[model samples]
Target: MRFLVDECTGPAVARWLEEKGHDVFSVYDDAPGIADSKIIRRSHEEGRILITNDKDFGGKVYRERSPHCGIVLLRLGNERGQNKISVLRRLLEEYAGRLPDQFVVAAAEQVRFASKEE
Candidate 1:
């Protein structure tokens, strides 16, 4: 899978995804401090899933109808760095196959998926 990892997601998540043989581009390294709209446009142009911790993307994607390849909004309850990485890693390991073309929320205990009809 191809991913455009947002700044708040941190380097750990990007590295883990790369290690799993997925193409990962991180805003922290590639375009530090860029605006979210630009980043979302880049993700759409590149056909990469936008993986972000920012909840704003959900509103932007749905209410604003932003163009995107896909979206994975990590809503992990734990704010610790390790906890975030762990939950994301587990989500990728267990549910990656179900992620494309959908808006997904991955929390510490559960994963929720949403699409246009839902």
Candidate 2:
């Protein structure tokens, strides 16, 4: 799958996803300091799922009804960097096949999936 990693997410997550053979674009390296709306627009235009730690994306996508391919909001809190990465890795490992066409909120202990219908 292709992904646009938001600036709020750590670089390690992008590196790890690339290592796992997914096409990954990281805003941190590609376009530093871009606004959230522009980043969301780019992700939509490029047909990429957005992986972000920013809850603001949720409001923009859902409340504002922004167009997007998909979004995965990582909601893990107060964890070590490595632990956060591990959570992301586990999410991909367990849900790679089911990730598309849905909005996913992945917390440390649970994952919630919502679609346009929901």
Candidate 3:
């Protein structure tokens, strides 16, 4: 899988993804301080699933109708890097094949897939 890790999502998660053999582009490492709109646009253009902690992206995709290859929105109760990685690990283990072109919200206990129109 290819991923665009948002700046706020941090380098640890990006590193973990890389270790898992996913092609990863880290905004924190490659392009710091970039705007959220550009991040989403770049992710779409590159055909990368965006990994972000920002709720604003829901508005961008749902309300503004922005196009995306895929998005994994982390709504974890524990925002620590390890917790994020654990949540992502579970999500990938269970739903990797179903991820593309979906808006997925991952929490500590559950994962939800939002309808594209929603």
Candidate 4:
């Protein structure tokens, strides 16, 4: 799946996805310190799902609705990027189409999927 990996997601997640043959773009890679609003817009325009860990995006989406491909907010209990990467990969494999719309937000304990109703 195409994705816009957030800055917080780290390079490890991005690399893993790339190895999986998914077209992934990272905020820290091409651009650094970009505003979330701009990232949201660009991701939507590019038809890429956003892979973020920022809880604030919920508010952002609430206040400003953009055509976001989708947003996966990660919250792995372990802050360690390695642990988070494992969870993320599992989600990506399990959730294919269902996620493109309502993506998974990884919390400390479990992963929650929140997508819009069709």
lDDT of each: 0.86, 0.85, 0.95, 0.77
Which pairs clash inside model 3? Answer: none
Q: Regarding TM-score, does 1 or 3 come out ahead? A: 3
Name the runs in model 1 displaced over 4 angstroms: none
The alpha-carbon lDDT assigned to residue 116 of candidate 4 equals 45
Cα lDDT for residue 11, model 2? 79
lDDT (10s digit) by residue, model 3, range 1-118: 9999999999999999999999999999999999999999999999999999999999999989999999999997789999999999999999999999999999899899986677
The lDDT-based order of candidates, best leading, equals 3, 1, 2, 4
TM-score ranking from best candidate downward: 3, 2, 1, 4
lDDT (Cα, tens digit) per residue for candidate 1, span 1-118? 9999999988888887888899999998888899999988999999899989999988788888888878988887676667877887788889888887789998888889898334
Per lDDT, the best of the predicted structures is: 3
TM-scores of the models, in the given order?
Answer: 0.91, 0.92, 0.97, 0.88
RMSD (Cα, Å) of model 3? 0.7
Residue 116: error of model 2 in Å?
2.8
Weakest ten-residue segment in model 2 by summed lDDT: 76-85
**Alpha-carbon RMSD of each model:** 1.4, 1.3, 0.7, 1.9
In terms of lDDT, model 3 sits at: 0.95
Q: lDDT, candidate 1, residue 98?
A: 82
Give lDDT tens digits, candidate 2, residues 24-85: 99998888899999988998899899998889988887788888888898887764557668
